[model samples]
Target chain A: MSAAVLVTAVSDNPLEDNPLEQEKVSLLALVGELDYTNAERLQHDLQEAIGPEVCNLVIDLTDLSFCDSTGIQVFLTIRKITQDRGGSIALTNLQPRLEKLFHLTGLAPAFGIQPTVIDALKVFRARQSSS
Target chain B: MTGDHGQQWPIDEDLTALRERLFQHAAQAGMRGERLDDLLLAVNEAVINVLEHGGGDGTLSISQDDTYLTVDVTDAAGHLDVRHIPRKRPTGTVRGFGLWLMSQLCDEFTIQRIAGRSRVRLRMLLHRSPTGAASPDSVSGDPGPDESWARSEVRSSPANGAGAHVDITHSGGTAPSPQQS
Candidate 1:
């Protein structure tokens, strides 16, 4: 009863590691780095890659190196987007810098920052089975 | 050869130009690849801060030694507080991430007041041959000062220090009165 896209990415680019991924999620979308210079691209890619079929979205960022306020805004926007579509989002491998960013911005509690990609995927599967 | 040269341009806007200069030097000294891009990002953010907040009516200078690249941005503004600004959500919500990213990316970052000008100097180490020249736009950093600090640490030189200075003029800057203060 759902659809999805799973992105495995690597990046030295500020916007994302992969610029060509576009799919729906009864699945997870793993992305890294969403800065002002590239937030729109991230949004477009995310929207194109994610959907209601994917009950839980997982963003793996163990390899992520940076983010600014614009990047944080992207997170808020995506969270709201997933919620409206009757789905959820989870972030794993949260780097120390990213962790500090979340706390500084008062968004730590609002995000489901898991410890690892494995945990995030497990949670999503639980959600899928429960429904 | 990459920027529209003029006086009083913001650093955020001139990162690519400044970095082009860096890449040229780094290449001659044999630097290349993602490392160059990373260095550019770190330096660009810092330069942008200098351009935007460090002073007014300014000219920045850049120099490269055998192993390190030195960039100085100065203007006639009051001394900038170099202390780290805690990472927090944007208060203005208008995309102000310049200084924050600079601090995150710089290795041996320092901000100080010198000769009536604010100076921010950043260094990045070179470990690759100059090839696949850096893109005109990009930024990156880490939690260590190894790259930056290494270059600045070798200070017991027998000769003069590499050139580093900037001039900023504001209050009716009548073509700058020649006053050596």
Candidate 2:
């Protein structure tokens, strides 16, 4: 079968009482394959998920089987948008192959990558407290 | 040289069918896991390049041997300049990563302009034979003799300049022949 990209969203902190912890973090779980054919869809889904109100974002890629340069492009686009809106983005559960791709392209550092969703959330939380 | 393992199909607008076909062929040829994914991604990038810039459509060919899996994507537009493929685009750039990623994923990547067509060849090493001995089933089909034709109009390598030397040849105004570079 041809490759496909499937995305689902999980919200952990939708609303917080404290303004410091108020940053809404939406975790997007991606599966299947991400390539030129379906990267645009992923980008659209991501754009739709994060709005002017929703800020902090974490992409869970535990089940992602494949990703190409187009996929990486989507990540860059999202990062730019999130930064422009005064938000943060992180990625968690990257497979070894995907990690290698980021490393080869020298993007590992540019992206906020953690081992798990919790760790990614922690990163956002740490930034909130530090700010 | 064309082998029995080689197959070609027309490039479609979305390239979904092409990706599926290439995936199945690579899997049947013994590629699995990340390697298969890499091959698919590389071929997809090449095909996308053709569809987006080279022309609206092109042709894709898949072939394999015991040690290497090869794919060739050809387009009518000869606008691609291989030497200009950037290894990394400035951060936040959306385009220009397809060719770079293909070069990184495949063991060898070469682009040639022949008879007003842009042909991109990508080869991935299936497995390294420790003894340096060819597998008995490696040469399953007759690839025919290699014959020289018109010289390539332009040829370019990745920034790293890795892999074997590629030879570009066309047969009596027919389909282009495979070269081991």
Candidate 3:
């Protein structure tokens, strides 16, 4: 009935005003369920948010109550896009059930999950520094 | 065991109502927490599979017993092959996760074609609380390959496509009566 998923994005480093580096890191907090019914809409939203300049993505699932295989497919598609641009994606605040789904599908390693958004951002920073 | 304890819902172009009905029925059945979430997700995937691929219409029959809650989704499009569903998780990222997910979430998964309609049956073990109400248990994780299909049964006859009359009982689990005309 209502929107199945709500995507809220925040620029992690807004003060770094370089055009090429501006908004490269985005923190998307997902609220509500993501399933086949609204997977396409969420994919479109994520694609729009992940522009050419934007690279690393941190998805916060603190309020995400449910996710199906279709929902997982959306993240996989975004992961490929980010990886192709020499960037990575991290997932934060996964509920236990969602975490179990990721583990069951053997996608935890591919997504680089973290306990919190801050920890995920730190990992991205570490990766950038090392590279 | 009788008509008083079970319900059926039609799966057509609109699934919003079907989902709501499921949530209400499942919650009233005493299912809570992630276990409820798991059942909803699994059944949602099954219904969507029917709409997207199985001639766009079907029926959902839900019944529960002392130890298991069962949902049987049957569609007129008899194209699904239980053998074709991926047993192991697919290595690719984008597709091929829906059927696998259905199998993984439920305690027993089975598919059989009857009278030219394909039916996918999903059964989840009901954990009872101290007061005898069904509730979620602490068991959460991947059951691995061996455990996922612990009580699955797939019967297909060569002459009738995927239709084979196989006994649909597992340790006292009752067979859902055929609803086809």
lDDT of 1 by residue, B1-181 (tens): 0112212334444333455666676566555654454455555555545554655345555555434455556656745634323233245443445544444444334555556766566555433224322222322333333232212111211221111112122222123222211
Weakest ten-residue segment in model 2 chain A by summed lDDT: A12-21
**Candidate with better lDDT, 2 vs 3:** 3
B31-148: candidate 3 lDDT, tens digit per residue: 8776677678778889888877899778999886656677889998988745435555667644556776676666557776666878888766666445333344434444333333
**Segments of candidate 2 deviating more than 4 angstroms:** A1-4, A12-23, B14-16, B87-94, B130-181
TM-score, candidate 1, is 0.43
True contacts kept of each: 0.11, 0.34, 0.31
Alpha carbon lDDT at B161, candidate 3? 12
Superior by lDDT: candidate 1 or candidate 3: 3
Question: Which predicted model would earn the best lDDT?
Answer: 3
Could you give candidate 2's per-residue lDDT for residues A66-120 as a string of tens digits?
7777788899889888788888788889997788678656688878988888787
Tens-digit per-residue lDDT, A72-92, candidate 1: 777778888878777777777
Stretches off by above 4 angstroms in model 3 are A1-4, A12-23, B1-3, B13-17, B127-151, B154-181
Report how closely model 1 matches the true complex, as a DockQ value. 0.11
- Candidate 2 collision pairs: B164-B181, B165-B181
Global lDDT scores for all candidate models = 0.49, 0.69, 0.70
Candidate 3 per-residue lDDT, tens place, A27-106, comes to: 78889877777888999988887777667888999999777777898999999999898888999899987887787677
The stretch of ten residues in a row with the least summed lDDT in candidate 1 chain B is: B156-165
**For model 2, how does the per-residue alpha-carbon lDDT over B82-118 read when each residue is reduced to its tens digit?**
4435533435554666776666666667666667888
TM-score of every model versus the real structure: 0.43, 0.76, 0.76
